[model samples]
Target chain A: MKKIKYILLATIIATIWGCKPEEFGPIVGSEENFLKEMQGTWSLTKVTQVDQNAVSNGWPYKQLDITNIYPYKELVVSFQGDASGKPSTFTITPGNSPKIADLNSGNWSVDNTKAPTVITLTNNGQTSTLTLGSYANLKNGKFYLKREKKVNGKTILVYQYEFTKK
Target chain B: MKKLILSIIFILSATLAFAQVTLSPATFTAEDEVTITLDVTGTPLAGTQDVYIWIFSNSDLPAEIIKKDGLTNGQWTNSADAAKMTKTGTNIFTFKFTGTTLFGQSPAELINFGFLAKTKDGTKQTQDYKPYKFDPLVFVPMQFRVFPSKMDQTDMTTVYFHQDLATDQNLQRMFDVKVNLVFYNDATPVPAVVATRTALVTVKESNILYSYSFIPERLITLTAGTKLTKFTYQFTGSVKDANGANVPVAGPVTEVVYTPFN
Candidate 1:
């Protein structure tokens, strides 16, 4: 009976050890935490492009300066208070060309249901996603989303919108 | 020697013919809509004879007018027909060429127009008219509409403007209009994004005032997180010369910064 009790204790210890602490800030790893933190308004200023394979091949991604490409300068976005990246919209006043409306209607979701999690934005029936890393590892004052695209004699503009919380 | 003497006499006659008419405002701006009075009343040319005026850039002069009896430059009229002087009154003729479009050149560029009285068949001819030179005025934005001259607690700074061609030059032809902005907290620019044209001034204009507003959030918060109180901005108007160099119509005009949440 004592041996069985020791075995039980050991099993409990192993199980507790197997579970890890939050990788981010207070109460990390919970999708709920990540979503809640994303609720406020964040201004998107920059978008960059990268070639992952080219990094090893000596060519890396470049940050695109689209400030002058106008029609749209910065995007002010707000997420819902809940874990759902929903009930959110972004405002952008255009500058030069490729005009985008002032308000872009969209729903958002974090796909942590699989490897290489992503946050997808759906607007006007079109969906765009950004790959996610450790949510807790997010640098204060800014957030980043990354993706991979194939170029078949076509252009692949990997947009990385640098955000500042408002 | 006889051929040389004939050539000299013909040249002299052509010079004499050129002196037959008086062109007022010998130098005019191409973009301006101005009236030019041409006095050929003193000349002996017949009323049936036409006075052809050919406008050309400085690059194209010593035209083929006398050589091939055709213009080496463009016509003054924005029409299929050439711009021929008309007898408005007596021997006095008038030639009014509207905006720079007639010369197919941008503002601030020089154009030369010469005149010669002759029929299309070279039947009745006058000497080549001395070249008339003009430098088109560099258009400037008539009035700048920097609204709210102050900012309210909004996410954007709004500006309105309407360029009237009748009162002002076409905004599109003017140089890029930039906004110089500096956000300050306590009368000091905490972080300088100086000489920033944060506001994208498109060439689009209308008789009715149009406007655009952008969030000054970045100009204030871009450097370090500082709560924005106010910002100072100015308007710098300019235009490009014939060589594409900026020619300032007016220096930068400073405007009072806006108050947020006011």
Candidate 2:
């Protein structure tokens, strides 16, 4: 009888432990959710010109930081999204800066939502592709894009643009 | 003993000041083809039909002296056909040979050499041997190197870019490299706009090294009272990026100080 009582007690303890509910940690957003962070206006923070030839051959001084050389700080760019949270339109307010995008306003679309690599802008039949250089700090309010110039199918220069959320 | 030492010093000084032998292109390295000219005027070997060069080195130490194989082959009695010099003019003989080959040693090993004109019987010869020196061979490989380190603006200066010595990742992988050059004059702090040019960098060694040659005077015309103080240059090329697109690349700005013509 004492053994039976002990068995019943052990069984009761095992049932209670087995019935415990599983717990899960807080959910983190995917790289795709960073896209929504691009909405609203951003100001140009810095500009850099990279010599692709020098960079490729392991030469030093391949990059020239020209943030202060040009009036890029006056430029403000705005990105808008539709109700479905998809890329819609982008507007450029370039006061005295070089026309990096070459368009004042255009419909834009990202190459991928999971990890966007390119942002293609189209207006009236003309299209331009701005390569995504970095989005590591997108949630923290920083983004980078690169504009490349090519000659005879060869990329000769890359102009990098850094934008900070306003 | 003091009188003998003084006599020996005087003889040595007279021998050094002597000018029986003269080499064309007076200054040359051991690897350069040199014409050895011997003037046998007033010497016993003058007007000899077949004159030979008795060449040797390290004359200070008789035990450690080394002679050219051609002279040794003659055994100092019967001159070898190879040792016979060509009679170029009246009482003048010339022999065309490189020091490295004639001495069978490197330029560094041949500290200095002396030679005397002699006959087949070795009985009639010059009063004393004439001494000659070879300039030291110097070459230092770097990412940016200039030949003949000390030079004036008028001299032909060659700039070299050792691709193998490049440390930048972009420079290491770049191709079709060329040099972009610009000169700065004393009048302006900036480089001369007219002197800016892109020049082809010729390959010194396939894929390992490249060089570009230019004379500062030829590259630009300096105004009166102005001189070329320095020149800035960079190596430019093309490279492929991650997207498989060809990208133009340029190296860091390098400046070479100029030595203005006096």
Candidate 3:
């Protein structure tokens, strides 16, 4: 009778643990949380597009004063160059041109396997198999954003951006 | 507990049921044109419906309908000749007055214009569309034009005044008119030691010309000793029209007093 009770208690604990929802770190990098985290303002600090050769080439990038990433049925990225920070919207597409896939709408997920962290973005009809990484330099400040991405076969890095907390 | 929940629900529902509408002026100017428009939309209705427009005098008189040309299926378009108001849509309407003369003088005036929406059953709705309530009072700038009919080398010249009337519409309201004469030497105008009244005439529709005359009262008063080289004057006055619109006029009217002083 003692053994049966112990077994029953162990089974109940295991069942509860299994049923409990998985927590993805403090940020909970789920699709909805990823969107919520990226909804505010973000400056382009570094952009890296990794080519097929696995070699990363950081382009000479000019960061706009501030960039705003907001959800409006689709992912909308806005930036302003002036001190007043008048913003204009831009669309992000994945891959090569002619057949450049739009990564504007749909769901997004983050993969934390790498050092910089990879963001997996998926849109309406297609998905980008490549992952993006945040800059490792600034970990203490609110300037947290995915500044680099693996594109084509190389890594492109964006070094600077103008962003304000919205 | 049920009553409390019911009251809370009623309050929330009432808060959500209220709607807001705003009206604005597209264009406004004293002389050339004035256009007013209303923007109406709310959660209570998806789209706008029938609307009625009316203009009332500030004196609480019965409002009048100033119709425009091109009316079809209840939509009205602005006319070319007269100031008019028209309904363009269930939520949008415009009142425009163009090419109206504003003579200087009189107290500031206000004209009240408004519109209302009606249901399909012809019942008045609850929205206030009075454009005149939000109407901005404008002060027409004064202008004066002075000219002499005759000029002699050494002879004294007299300045006469003319009448004023509303050129666009026939109305019988006149305002106090005043003209100041200043003699200028060379190209620059010289301030007069004393202001002489050129005319004190009332404006009448038949009398389009308000006349005033200025004669040299004494020869010794002339500083140039009848050898007046140049003479120019400015006129200023105020006018109030039948609609209680105040207009002001001010500016210089130039006339040659003499040929030249040797």
TM-score of every candidate relative to the true structure:
0.28, 0.36, 0.20
Evaluate residue B138 in candidate 2 and report its C-alpha lDDT on the 0 to 100 scale: 49
Model 1 ranges with Cα > 4 A deviation = A1-28, A51-56, A60-73, A82-103, A113-116, A133-139, A147-149, A152-157, B1-262
Residue A137 in model 2: shift from native, Å?
A: 1.2
Model 1 lDDT per residue over B1-262, tens place: 9999999999998776655554432334554344444545445455554554443444345564222122323333321245566667655555666435665555544455555554444445544565566643332343554432223323334444444422445344444554555554432213243334554454334534444445564433454544545454544457777898877653334444333221
Candidate 2 lDDT tens digits, B123-163: 88775564577756644346776543433454445667787
Q: Model 1, A66-131: lDDT tens per residue?
A: 444343344565655433543244333333332222234466666652222676767777876566
RMSD of each: 21.4, 21.8, 32.8
TM-score on B-chain, cand. 1: 0.34
Task: Please report the candidate that would top TM-score against the real structure.
Answer: 2
Candidate 3 total steric clashes: 49
Off by over 4 Å in 3: A1-166, B1-148, B153-174, B185-206, B217-220, B224-226, B241-248, B255-257, B260-262
B157, model 1: CA deviation in Å?
29
- Shift in Å, residue B135, candidate 1: 49
Best by lDDT: 2
